[model samples]
Every structure is written in C-alpha cells, then in structure tokens.
Target: MDTDRAAAVDPIDVEVGFLTPALRSDLLERWNEPQRRYHNETHLRAVLRAVDALEADGEAFDATEVRLAAWLHAAVFDPTESENNERSAVFCERVLDPSAPVEEVARLVRLMGGHRVEVGDLNGAVLSDADLAVLGSDPETYDTYAADVRHEFAHVPGERFVAGRIVALEGLLERKSVYLTRAGRDMWEKQAHANLNRELGLLRAGAAG
Candidate 1:
C-alpha cells in the first residue's frame, strides 16, 4: 500500500483520548493569541495532512507518535528563545503519563529543534518533511507564513530579527535536502530552493536599504 492510503486507514488508536479534549481546548485558546499566528491550528492541520500523505506510503514512521509529536511540538515556543524545542518536549513529558513510554515523543520533539539529526526512519522523515512543507507551498501561502513568522518576533529589533531569520534560512539552504520523503523532495525541492533564493534576495535588499 502506498503511504497516503495506509496513513488514512491506519487508525492511530492510542490513548490520546485522555488528552484530546483538554489538549484541543488548550490549543484552541493558544491559537487565538496573536503571537501564535504562525503556529495556529491551521499549521497543525497542514502538518497532519502531510503526515497522512507520508503514512499512506507504508513508511516506517510510528504514526501515533509522530501525530502526537506534531500536535505538541510547538507547545512552548517563546518566539525569542532557542530552547523552544526542549521546552516543548518537557511539556509533552509532563502532560503525558509518567508510565507511558514517551521517549519517542521526546526524541521527535528534540529532532524538531534543528536539522542536525539524520532522518533514518520513515517516521522521522515524514515528520521532518511535514514541518518543512510550509517552505514549499505556493507563493501566497509561503508569503503568509513568512509574515506570520516575522510577526512572531515583533518584539525584536528589525536587524536582529532579519539576521536570525536569515541564519535559519541559510541553515535550511545548506541542508542535504529539506524535504526528506522521495515524493516531497521530487515535488517541492526546486520550489523550496526558488522560494529561499527569493527571500534571501529580499532580506539582502532590506539590509542594504
């Protein structure tokens, strides 16, 4: 079975029922905050769709773990701090039962902090690709994402913000490949590169001006 079909039918029947209602409510509340414009439920839904597409291919990812991690990954970002991933992982651990083996969740959360870890497994690759798919979206979608990201650090000075964002953009550009899945890379790699280049040009122009 292909990943898309498999992911759709494969029921992620975890005990997420315990966390679903409260978590959803909390997430919704958080989404309403202006600071969460980029990390809103809309972004979560897009990631979930990407996750489903990857799963349908019978990829080796742990569906339940990846799904949970995707939902919880940005739970604690400060918009100014570098420990957002670590803080998110810690929050997941605390919210989940101590007896429940959440090591995979923690590992995935940590992996989201940066692109340093090798995506050796199907699950890891899927999660990583989903996170990055935003960069490969249509120009309007990507532009909205860029704006939201800038809004996230509205408190920072323009130079500091642009410098930090440029560093992140360069890091992605330097990666072996931003989209790990074969399908994702095939379909989106060129577009991602183009988008990055365009953004880099804009950043340079802004800095120069």
Candidate 2:
C-alpha cells in the first residue's frame, strides 16, 4: 500500500481536535519561559497569521499540517542549544497526527532550521515562507525583531553575537530567495533582500567598530 500517498489525501484535518487544554498550557509555558525573548507567543502568532494570509491569498497545501507546524516550529527554541529544531520536530511528530503523515509533519518542522523547501512542496513552501515573513517586515518592525532576537541570545557577548549575526545575515543574503511561496516571493522577496542586506551592513560595521 502507498501509505505516503494515501496519507496525502488529507493534508490537515483541522476540524479534528488535537491541542488539548493541558497541551495548550504546556505550549504557553514553553513560550513564556524566561530565557525566550523572541521565540514566544507573539512570534508564533505572527507566523500563524502569515500562514492565514497566505492561505487566503495564495496557494497553500496541507494547510492544517502547516498550521500545526507553526505552533511547534519554535517550541524548543534555545539560544544555547543547537538541536532545538530536531527536538521540537520529535515532539510535534508524536502529537501532530499518528494516523496521518506524522513524519511528514516532522519533516516540515525540521525545515524551519534553514527555511528551505523543495520547489513543488507547497506545504513546506507555505510554512517556511510564513516563518520567514519577518524578514520582509518594515524597517521598524524588523528592527524590533532584531532587538528581540539579541535579547533572546542575551547570554552571549555583544561582540560575539554581532559577529555571529552578521554571518547569519550574510548567509541569508546568499540565498536565491528566502521566501519560497508565490505569495511570499511576490510580496516579500525584494523587501527581504533589502532588509537582509541592510542588517548585514549595519552588523558588519558594528563588528568593525
């Protein structure tokens, strides 16, 4: 039997309840953890809203799965830990949908690491693009986000963080397009590039100083 193909028939069973009250409370607790400055409910909601907007205006497949991915994508965020995505994906897989393509859910969650998706994978494209929509945010919003991110990594020294941040920004700049969905590409690609370049320049100058 083609299990993967059969599971694809129902991408997201949104109507089927999954997030219990206990689960919701646990999720909120993690988001509200003291160590988190940026990967909190606010950022999660922003990504959720971005997904909503994308669904309303663009092509998004397996939307329920994408929405669930939004909830759990940053669930294990830790500035000091490198396995946040992997850890989060594992947890999400266990809870997302057992009968469905749960591993597929994990795959999408893992993609949050680089925000990269196969060209034809709309589920991945939508989720990844929505997660990165912040990059295309207006200057003021983007600045606030940057500040929040630095706060998240508060344990790190300013110089070290800035140097690392510049490296990350430069990597983003090198991407052909950070936002992969059609809506993302049309609405945010140019703005995202401009934002990335501007930040990289500022961070580079700061590092030099």
Among the numbered candidates, top TM-score falls to 2
* 192: Cα error in model 1, Å: 0.8
Worst 10 residues of 1 by lDDT: 9-18
> What would you estimate as the lDDT of candidate 1?
0.77
Give the residue spans of candidate 1 off by over 4 A: 1-19
Candidate 2 displacement at residue 8 in angstroms: 31
Candidate 1 lDDT, tens digit per residue, 1-209?
Answer: 56555455523222443356677567556555566879877787778777766665445667778888887778786777879889989988888766545788878888888745574666677888888888988888899999998888798899988998888898889988888888778767889998988898899889989
Candidate 2 pairs with clashing backbones:
none
- Encode model 2's per-residue lDDT on 1-209: one tens digit a residue: 35445334432222324555566667778878888888887887778767766776747488667777777787887889989999999888766646656777789989988776777988999988888899999988899999999888888998888888888888788788787777888888888888888988888877778
